[model samples]
Target: MKLSTVFYFTILFIFISSASYSQAILQKNISLDVNRQRLENVLEILSNKGDFYFSYNSSIVKKDSLVSFRASNKTVKEILTELFNNTYEFRESGNYIIIRKAPIRMTLVTQKGITEEKIYSVSGFVYDEQSGAAISEASIYEKKMLASALTNEDGFFKIKLKSSKTSTAELTVSKEFYEDTTIKIQPRFDQQLSITMMPVEIPENNTVIKPEDYLAPDSLQVPTDTTEQQLPVSNDSIKVQQTGVGRFLLSGKQKVQSLNLKNFFTTRPFQISLVPGVSTHGQLNSQVINNFSLNIFGGYTAGTNGFEIGGLFNIDQKDVKYFQAAGLFNSVGGEVKGFQVAGINNLVQDNVYGFQAAGINNFVTGKMHGFQAAGIYNHVSDSVKGFQVAGIGNFSKEKASGVQIAGVSNISNREMNGVQIAGVVNYAKKLKGLQIGLINIADTSAGYSIGLINIIIKGYHKLSFSANEVENVNAAFKTGNSKLYSILRAGVNLSDSNKVYSFGYGLGSELSLNKKKTLSINPELSCQYLYLGSWDYLNLLNRFDLNFNIKLGKYISLFGGPSYSVYVTDQDVAFGGYRFPVPPSHYNTTKFSHKVTEIQP
Candidate 1:
């Protein structure tokens, strides 16, 4: 009887242990009511009940339609099984569960049904699981190895990697709009694989994130000094728990910088680079810096102290000193002291002192002190001190105090203090110097401009009609600023055909003599072709005059001038072709040969 009792107790103990293990393995109970909720939302609700996370294929799972579910103190397994039924498969991996479509595994049969361990090439094809359609541009990589490949347009791919002793590789497949699929028993044999991926169903409430989320600090931020005991570590450091820049909901530009980044980067004496990734900054050859540097392709670092050269490009984080030359591009962050030259572009962040030359473009954000020349365009934001030249265009935002020459156009935004010469057009908000171009435009002409069309907002424009001693009715149109003006005049007689029809153009200016009476002086020079008959006649008249003007009102002015004339003609005519000599008429014999016509009207 005692033996029987012991046996009974042992049986009871085993039964209780098994029961306890089942209870412990059971998932937590959850109670919630969801009304037409998305599958993603339902998964989220399930995850919140315990320490479980769900990963599923979005394309296979329908998340757009609302799902209605009501469960009270139900196990998670029961709830999920009821929701998906036979439509998907769930595999638990630690705290995570991967959800995917029904699996269709294909196996290879070796000769004599014998499998051997050996290294071999691997190839594969990726396709959509639901439709069996080929998926292109899908990335495939071994989880633990550096072997990677991408699917071609026909969904074919190949990769080379070491064969695993276990004859399996963890292959991870991912593509745009598709859920990631991993093959646990990855093929290491000389065989092909057919991978199927489902499209991801995006959830409305899910946080958006790119595939590659760069959460590391920006490269521009300067490192903090750990040597200082008084420095606050909390303020200087940045904590990014996520693997991305997750601030996508921002409506406007957000300036986010590490506390230490606002300060300047540590200074360096010199550095060298043979290419972009190979440089002294990355090599850590010296703790401080060098005074001289050289490069074969490109260089990028904090700053330069002496001279630097590159075959392709040169990039500086802050400042550069002495000289720098590059075959392609040169970029400076803060300031430059000496000279910089590049084959393509020379860009300065803040200011430049000496000189800069580029094959394409040169730009200075702050100020230009010396000379800047470029083949295409040259621009200065603040001011220019010396000479500026460009093949196409030159621009100064604030002021220009030197000389500017361009093949196309020259523009000054605020004010000008020197000279600007362009082949096409030139413009200044306010001119305090000289401008020469085909078209010169200014708002206020405090200096001078010479061109075919000179427009000044505050200077002279006049249309005058007057009678002169030589011509009965003469009309002149004048336009310009205070510094210079152009005059175009024409005259004709009413009754006589050969009374002389003249057309002329000249340059002159008005000088203020008295402020009270608005008196001024006008000096002009003109050359006119007198038309006696047609193109068969040859007559040229050059005149130089000095006139005094008196302004009576806003629109009316009186002016007269004494002119010295030189007339040349091939033939002697009535009143259009010839003029008498400069000798006294009393001693001249040809005085009787000339006739003068007087004004009739």
Candidate 2:
């Protein structure tokens, strides 16, 4: 029983053990081969062309290195199929991959530097009107306070500004006796603009005077005497007499007394009459009287006479006659062959032949002839005369003859043949020349002339001159304030007789003192072109200005400043930037400086 059974069992046990060992060895070999194949695939993917970012789990891995990976399956089925008979297992987390080879690293680099900014500039001009003159020393600035420039003698200006902000720039211009101007500037890289300025109002020089009168009486009464033997007298008396009849009537405390006599003449050729508070006369020739009162005063004469009164009023004269009076008011005298007189307030004179006079609180009787004299508080005795005078508190006696003078408080006593004088207190009698007062007149063989404050005339000509210059650089030259003409002129020009032209250039600087006030400085250059006959002339000018302006109110301001100017003229010079041939040159240049203060009202 033992030998055969033992040998068989031992052989069977040995075969079983051998088969198990062989299986274990085959499984290990499969796993190694799968790992190797995976590593090769990962390496191939890493070494592919084109740039890419390399990433891994928390641990960094070198690029361009072989890596290993396996399918996420428990069985070795996929590993054997993909990696040639192998059995392996692997787990992946985020970007991590199980690999057999170490990784390689790579880096990149870059470079850097700096650049510059660019700047730009602009230029333009301004000009004047009326004489076609070049307005030098004109102010030029950016309307928005962004930039500014001024015109030179040729009304030219240059400005430097940032090119990037070109769209924001605007040009502004200002000059004396001309309104301000502004132009929109679209500076094309660097550009030049031409502009013009128009003339402004030219103020006149004049004076006005007003006078007062107090010697005016509320009423006046005059009485006359007549004989009842040769003339019939009735309650309402109406008398008809010849041309040469003298009558006197006396009444006792009468409420109403009037004389209706037409065509009555004085007997004496030259007579003098004096009365109380009032006096009445008709047709007196060549007579001199003083301190007389007239009620419904009337006169007609062919010669000369002088009548003076305190508050004489209402006198009428016709035909050629001359009369003089003083200190009269509210009277009328006119239509005399020689002269008539009425003086003071409400005094009117008309149609006089020779001369008439009137005074304060008095009026002219009638039309004046040669001349009429009246004073303030008085009026001319007549009209249509050579002259009339009426001063304050004074009136005319009859009518003025040669010259009429009217002033404050004037007086007239004797009959003046040359001129009449009326002032606050003045006198004239056959005067040849001198005249004085706030307003006075003197007339002889020479022409008549009137003056205020002072008057000195040479021959028949009078010379008057006025100058005004404003330098405002700091003020904003708003485009809203510029006119069309000012926007187009930018240079200086000159011309003769029939034709004219001008050009100008300027520069200006302004510092804002406040939102509304500013300090300004301006420099100007201008060149003028003139054509006389076939010749052309060129003039150069330069000016500088400095000013401070204060805004007093919305539409008003107080401005004051100083200025310096220069001008030159050349006979042989040519202009640039023009395609025309060089023309004949005649130039002029001048320099001046001054300080001024003004109140803009």
Each model's RMSD to truth, in Å? Answer: 17.7, 53.8
- lDDT tens readout by residue for model 2, 1-601: 7988999999999888776544332132222212322232332322121111122221112222332444442223244235322222222222222321121121111111211335556665454532334556665554332244446677667776555544545665655445666666554356665566655432231111111111222121112223222222233321111111112221211101112111222322232323211222221221112223233332222223333222333222222233444334322222334334444333333443454444434333554345444434544443323555454444445434455455554433334455445443344432334344444322211222222322222221111111222111122221100010001112212222222233333323334556544332222222223322234544333444454555455555555565554434443433443212212122222223221111121
Full-model lDDT, candidate 2: 0.34
Model 2: worst 10 consecutive residues (lDDT sum): 479-488
TM-score of each: 0.51, 0.21
In model 2, the runs with Cα more than 4 Å from the true position are: 1-260, 263-334, 337-350, 357-362, 365-370, 373-601
Quote the positional error of residue 339 for candidate 1 in Å: 1.1
Error of 2 at 197 (Å): 87
Global lDDT scores for all candidate models: 0.66, 0.34
lDDT score, candidate 1, position 247: 24
